[model samples]
Target: MDLHYSPFDFAIQKDPYPVYKRMREEAPVYRNEEDDFYALSRHADVVAALKDSERYSSKNGLRLEPAFWGPQAEQIFSFVALDPPRHTRLRALVQSAFTNKRVQALEPRIREIGKAHLEPLLSGDTFDLMHFAGGFPTDVISELVGVPEADRAKVRDLGMAIMYREPDGGPVKDLPPSAMAAVGALVGYYTELTIDRAKVRQDDLLSGLLDAAEGEDRLTPEEVVSILILLVGAGIETTMLLLGNAWHAAAAHPDQKALALGGRIEDWVEETLRYDPPSQTIARTTVADVEVHGTVIPAESRILLMTGAANHDPAVFENPDAFVLGRDTAGSLAFGYGRHHCLGAILGRLEARIALEALTAHIADYEIDEANAVRIGSSNNRGFASLPTSFTAR
Candidate 1:
């Protein structure tokens, strides 16, 4: 097969690892002039770009969708699209809310949510784990962010639309009308939620952010709304993929599944992130001319950090394609790097760990119908839209 890479292409989406491996070995600095982006596939180059925020700035936007650039994007993205001081200021405000103690405190609730979904699935022979993956994360995040139960369904649907329309979604440049409507709906809903929470002060992350302050410096309504929108997008998508990929990996590799069954699910979870990261790519625009691997990326040009490829770079990990336990994942870029490492990293890992624990404990044996699995072609991440599986109840 040709070693072409296109996130929007379903062929590449089904199995990107082989192409990623080729990119690392053959075109370490792969260029897609047609797509208007330069891709870095090697671990050394990718990590260097990730850390050098001064040159390869995320200020343009980290999403693979180039349309999500500009002042307007920041208004909705909050700190995710900002550089240094601005990013630092906004990120610090909410840092306390996701602290170790606080995230650990949510484990009981996360476990409860995880087990609730598993027990019912245990009664059935065939089920799509994607529902559990998609539902559990949103539920936990919604409750944490104080989204009222009555409104969660509507808001969750809007969030999905805002990211990607279901059933053959179109390009970002030509987003469906419903997705466009979702864009507005999300901002309005979050704006109202932030305002209401500011007044009532509930005991949830939303209220916590409303109270997130440093003397006179506090989160403005716009900032609060932006964070809420970001939380919804980031919180659900990646965590869902993390869970989906973990189960998929376990099913594909019996050695890993045996390990998971042997109370080594944590190792499986980490290996899953490294082997198949929920987020495959991170985009940045050059603020200044930079040279990498003898390839000079010009200023104002787009750079696609091939994190998915880097996770499997042979120089970084031995037998890079294999999902083996106890592999050294110290330098894995799964949660990102430098100033933009996911703030929800702790929360995401905790959620995946608990969910994996529940699956291994309750579902004794399972096999995913990969031939018919629902694959969603996304701009930045790769994951199943539905993973139909037949399982044996424990």
Candidate 2:
């Protein structure tokens, strides 16, 4: 049998499902020689690996490459990249802001921002949803988390460059010199912002973090910076991909677009997640030796959970290839499973729903400019870098 997979295949970046399908059927747990990391493609196996944190620890770090953080910095980020008591404590410190009620309270505000940004574009015949509709949430999260409006543009640029990886979902080779400079600038800006927030103390997530850090579980000042980076970086990048991908998906399917526009956007959002998840893969490292589906993975082996493949497993979802709105696969590991599941899942869903609803409701028809709509150069995230479209406003 021949297996053709690399961590930087441009073709796979455009559409990885076919390759993932082949992987799931033929090689449920495959180790790619190119990257030297093991991948789990089947839904059941991936879910089990995610849940069994003791066996599959996160301490090895989630990124495909090492040195994203220096030795000391890596230890701090390992809070998310580790298992058990540490992940639990750190996650609990920030979990309150991501609760259903907290996310629900922001829906009206999100809708308003969606309308404000989208309505102007609706009057135009065509526009790039990635810039207009998709970019709105990045700004929204920045504002909600107390990033001053003036600094958000810089934040967005830095976040996008850092998050977008190569096609095979591998980390970028290294930040360009300019990007490195931008990182320093961003860190300085956020450092000042954190100091100011400490003084003024407003009603925002950043302020909440300051207040929450009371006793032993309290986040240090540096930890606060790390969490802000995670929040702004993860929040912006994932939502941007979701909105961008959802728009592209809807433009391709008219009936589904109509259904989405007709007050059924949640179905469309869910289907989009199942069809083309933003976070295509997540990594876990084994703590103790573990055998998954007859494959013996040594302790300390890195495991990659292919969420894109897991969502399409026929044994889990009926007609896995077909995009059926409102089809509920109760066990879809789209947001992942167990302790390290996305903290902002609800916020992401709400943002996607609002963006999709606004676009479908306001635009008569839109088509993807395939000639120019490029995929973001990231292995772990799957979405367009730019989605130019022509549309008629309703």
Candidate 3:
């Protein structure tokens, strides 16, 4: 069999671990001529590239699609696409608002929101877990961003539209017109929200972002809108997918699922992240000619740091395929590494933990209707779009 890998390939996207394993052993520095990108599948190489931002630059956003890659990438990805200095400054200012205190304080509210959403879905018969998975995080983020209750559904729909694509397409090379429209709509909506918040300051993240100052500097209106837009995908979509993946994985492994349901929510979150993460591939551009495993990847070349492949490398994880709870996942790149590490990670985990805790409090067990489960088609993300699940209530 010939060695071939492309993130755009639907078959590969559906279950990439097999191909990732092959790439790790056969070609650590794998190249796909069809997509015009190089991929690093080995754990060591992916981690090294993630850490050495100087060589593996993130200036071209995190995905290789034509619409997302380039100097203007930050408009969509915000500070995530920027290299140091600029990244450092903006992150600092944003952090002043997205403080630990702010996130930690949301636990009570997260529980409240969790109960509000989870209670209705526990009607006994099969219900799509995605209904809960998708709505919970959006409401949480909307609450944080000061979005009115009426507007949250619209926000979630827009976010879902942006993250969705047909999993059986030719090649998801770029965002379709519908997704582009969703982006424009979200931007316009946030622009109005930010402007309104500016007029009347509220105790929300948006207001905090507007006032987040380093010395005399503060985030401008445009910057705040960009950050909010970034949150629609980062803060909401990622967490939403993580919850769905956790639920689906637990259903697949009953023993591990029992442990998770038996007050090991933290372990559940951590293992799910390592075993099958939402973020599968993150792309970067080579700043200089880089030689890895005898292959010289030229400067300015697009490269993908295959985090999904790295997580399953036996060299790093013992019995990497098993869904083991409480295993050591020390060097996992599930949330990325170094400069580009996900800022919303803490909030993401917190939301998952609380949401699951709420679920376990009510349900004894749940079963996923895998035959009808629909996986969201994305180049970098991997998770369910519609997971019809039946629950056994406690």
TM-score of each: 0.95, 0.92, 0.98
210-285 per-residue lDDT for model 1 (tens digits): 8888789988888888888787668988898888888888889987787787788778888989999988998888
Off by over 4 Å in 2: 67-78, 165-175, 213-216
Q: Clashing residue pairs, candidate 2?
A: 58-81, 165-377, 165-378, 166-377, 169-379, 169-380
lDDT score, candidate 1: 0.82
Lowest summed lDDT across 10 adjacent residues in model 1 is found at 165-174
Model 3 per-residue lDDT tens digits across residues 28-103: 9998887899999989999899989899898999998888999888999998888888889999999889988999
Candidate 3: regions farther than 4 A off = none
lDDT of 2 by residue, 1-394 (tens): 4876544565666778888899998889898766777899999888888888878777766656544422333332435665678778778877754457767877788888888778776666767777874568777888678888787777878766656444435445444567556556666776788899989998778887777753655766676777776665467777888888777787677788777667778888888889888888877777777886798888877678888899999989998988778899577777888888888888888788777777777766678887888687765778877788888666
Tell me, what's the RMSD of every candidate?
Answer: 1.8, 2.5, 1.1
By TM-score, the better pick of 1 and 3 is: 3
Cα-based lDDT at residue 110, candidate 2: 83
Error of 3 at 366 (Å): 1.8
Candidate numbers, best TM-score first, in rank order: 3, 1, 2
> What C-alpha root-mean-square deviation, in Å, does candidate 3 show against the real structure?
1.1
